[model samples]
Target: MFRIPASNNGLYLGSVPQSAAAKNGGTLITLDHDMATLPAVGRTLTVAELAEHVDDMAGRLWAAGIRPSERVAVHMSPGFDIYVLATAVARIGAVPVMLSPALEGESVAALLERLDRPHLLTDGAKLDGPLADFPVADLTDRTVVATGSRPGAVSLDDLAGAPRQQPVLLHPDEPALMTHTSGTTGLPKLVVHSARTLRGRFRPQERLASLVRKRETVAIHVSYVHSRMYLALAVLLPRAMPLVIMNDSEPAGVAELFAETRPGFIETHPNSFMEWEELVDHPRRPLANVRYFSTTFDAIHPSTMDRLLRASERRAPLFFQIYGQSECGPLVGRGYTRKNAHKADGRCLGFAMPGVTNFRLVSRNGARPSRDTPGYIEVSTAGRALTYFGEGERFDQQVHGGWWRGGDVGYRSGYGCLHLLDREVDVIPTIHSTLEVEDTVLGRLEELTELVVVAGPDQEPVPVVCTRNDRPLEAERWRAAVADLTPMAEPVQMPLTELPRTATMKIKRIELSQRLRTQEGRAS
Candidate 1:
């Protein structure tokens, strides 16, 4: 019953080939922006073919000099290449620092510098562009590798010439993976995870697996660089469930793909779900076959939930909204149906995931013994990350005793369900709860897609809204929406796509506010 899985090598990689061998391989789609490319369209592989590919990549990565505790920065878009290459690095016990393409070049260079400019692996586009941001003097000290040609970098294809080698195993506490947090409030910091912390997620993934019937098709369009994504793939791909992995969440593209696959379970970021809500009007009704909808990373608006459930044809389709952070895998989970979606309070995030997490509230006055009094959220979770890479002192600051500070302000309802108000840094000095006010406005208007409250010039609550169909904001509707609450600044309209976002789709309030202030200065 005991499994001695290779460290840093996601366990599923070792087991998937064996489990899938001698059987029809489940589908693995690598949906990317370049739909015309070979890696984009769905690639169907037999278990043997999948096994062969993993082995080949693993061997190549070992040949590339990726060794135990080595850091390899991955600077590619999410797709088959990224997944395979990152896994290959893990196979050799080198930690893959998962970086997002959406990250700005300046931030990327700064983060690389902070990480001590570890071995950089990127593509032709990044080598000549993003990578150019680093100081010229620094390039001489680091080994650069990329798929296409670069003056000083080694060609990735050269790895094929080097002999293949078996994976290097390490202790459970050794570093295995590294990814940056969303950085909604400040510069993103790298978070490191070891087999010890990562193994805790295995049980929850297994529990999630039992909920889905064996062999049911799964369609996933979420971030690959996210901390839990590798673990998720480790569990799902090996289960032999046919999969559709998408990077581009464009409504028509995803709808067309789902029409052909007819996936039973659909999992994506909450924002993607909202983006896909337009599929409700699609002639094919893409979500009709979906039985379960899983959303993680942040709280979702009730309207977004309502639109999606009504579109699904299932009689009792369940929507799982997960509330937690990358530092901690998942602290709480709550499910809502069409009937209960509208009934949900704006803040009722969820109850703790059983046997996996322990949570408490530390108020300004200290620990709160009762419910409904909002306070700083804290948790002791089996799945918490080991530390912030290069910032062990910062990691120590967030922990008190054995509990990890969640950096959120929320309270437990009388029924024990959690209600998150605002992130500690996002809090406004409004007479009312800033997030509660945003939720109230959301409930009042059906056409409003998203509303975020940020501090304005006078330090008052200023609401930024993304309206459906890009409709003009009506002052009357806005006035009525917040009529009973504290007087607030007039709403500022913003296009949803223009909003600065973390990889998970959570808005960057501080960034957007600063941008707006700069624009105002120019106009005045």
Candidate 2:
């Protein structure tokens, strides 16, 4: 068994023994563009191999001047190398600043500028054009370790021969990972997590014993830079060999990999799961080995959950849905089984994760009320981040004392399940009353192919619905739909052709809202 020091201060996240995997005879599997084909169970690296690689990589990073507590930026595709580098950084007592490869030009540049002078570890081919435009040289004096050959870049192979160094003993409170908040409001804020906080937030003990027994083959299809990887690996590692899918995690790609790898469990975002639904012709494949599926990052529409349940042949338990923010960590999860499916109102995020956390609901208008009363959800947990980096004002407003205000308004049901109402900004207050405009729009347009609701600058709600056909939605049908609601919310039905979205498929509500206001002003 791996033994990490029980320290209240200076907790280091990567302090667990590197050789523990080798001692237990486990393995590590990774898939990337460099591989001849998707990695299968038999072809994956053994635990001994992974531990040796981590040791070698850590030594090389130290030789390259990555001192303890220094931050090393990792901008690479998901794979075995990514995990190795992350583990290596931790073993050396350095922080791993993970950046999603899917992040676009401006977001990437903004993040890089915020984390100045970081030792970068990346797949150089992915960094060719867009990253070259930035003042990379001035930002960091450190050298980059590129996985593949690139002009003026050092290769990973060169580091294998580097001399090994003693692992740094770090306190539990030391920052281990740097993650960015979802840029939902303005620029994305940086969040710093410590080893103590992560351990407390994600109680790795409960799942470890079972996971070890199964020795399950697991596939991590989400971006390693995201919080999902941290949550999944921290819980899955003691027992199973994690298969990292580095390239596009689209359904077609993931299905092909699944067919080859035969992983017992798969972890991914709801969007990727939906994409997978569209790619495969058969709802149920010969996925005899697979047993569990988990989703996070965003809420999955009930329809998408239905599709997943059907596709898995009801062979696996209901897909697990986890809800949390980058600052608060993962706070809640629900198992989507047939027994609980009918009970779900498509609103309850789930009950709290038992022991590691607790929650409170503070009214948007400032009063604490009973169940059925909607208010902003505030969470207090041991896993909450220590501080928001570079966003003092925003951080102060959101976090008061130990309670982090999650801006999203929700309420508890009589049955003790938590139901998310809407985000503070997403709620529309009409002349008569307030209403969760987005929830109503999404529920009403359930039959539509796609839909998004944006609050216009005039503070009016506009619904953009995409249907399979090009036919326009009639004025009467739109009016009737809005009229049937409890608190009447004004709806402007627009074609889907006019909507804007982010790289991760989130609607750009602010931009669309601005456009709507401009058009309304012109008409007036």
Question: TM-score: which candidate is best?
Answer: 1
The residue-by-residue lDDT of candidate 1 on 1-524, one tens digit each, is 12345544334333345355545464454343442112422455444555666667666666656566778888765565566667667766777888887787777777778778687767767656766666633732345454545676666566655676666655667677888899887788899887667777666666777787746778877677886677777777667777777777888788888888888888888778878878988999888988888877788877778778888897788888877788878778788899998767868888876787778777855667343457878888877888898899999999999888878888877888888888878777664467777767787887787788888776788889988888998988888888888887888898888989988787888988788788778988
For candidate 2, lDDT tens digit of each residue in 1-524? 12345654533445332544644545565564543111322345655566666777788788777888788878775554666677788888888887766566567677777777777777655567557667656665564654545555656656657888777755666677887766666666778887777776566223422533455567766665665565665555545556555456545566666766766666676656645554334433634355666766666666556555555543444567777777877777677764554334667677776666677777766666443457878887787886766666777898867788978887877777777766677666652222233344444554454555667665665566655343666667666666765443355555555556433345566676777788889999
What is the lDDT, from 0 to 100, of the residue 294 in candidate 1? Answer: 86
- List of clashing residue pairs for candidate 1: none
| Quality of model 2 by C-alpha lDDT | 0.63
* Poorest stretch of ten by lDDT in candidate 2: 34-43
How much is the lDDT of residue 104 in candidate 1? Answer: 74
Model 1 TM-score is 0.92
| TM-scores for all predictions | 0.92, 0.82
The best candidate in terms of lDDT: 1
lDDT of 1 at 33: 45
Clashes of each: 0, 9
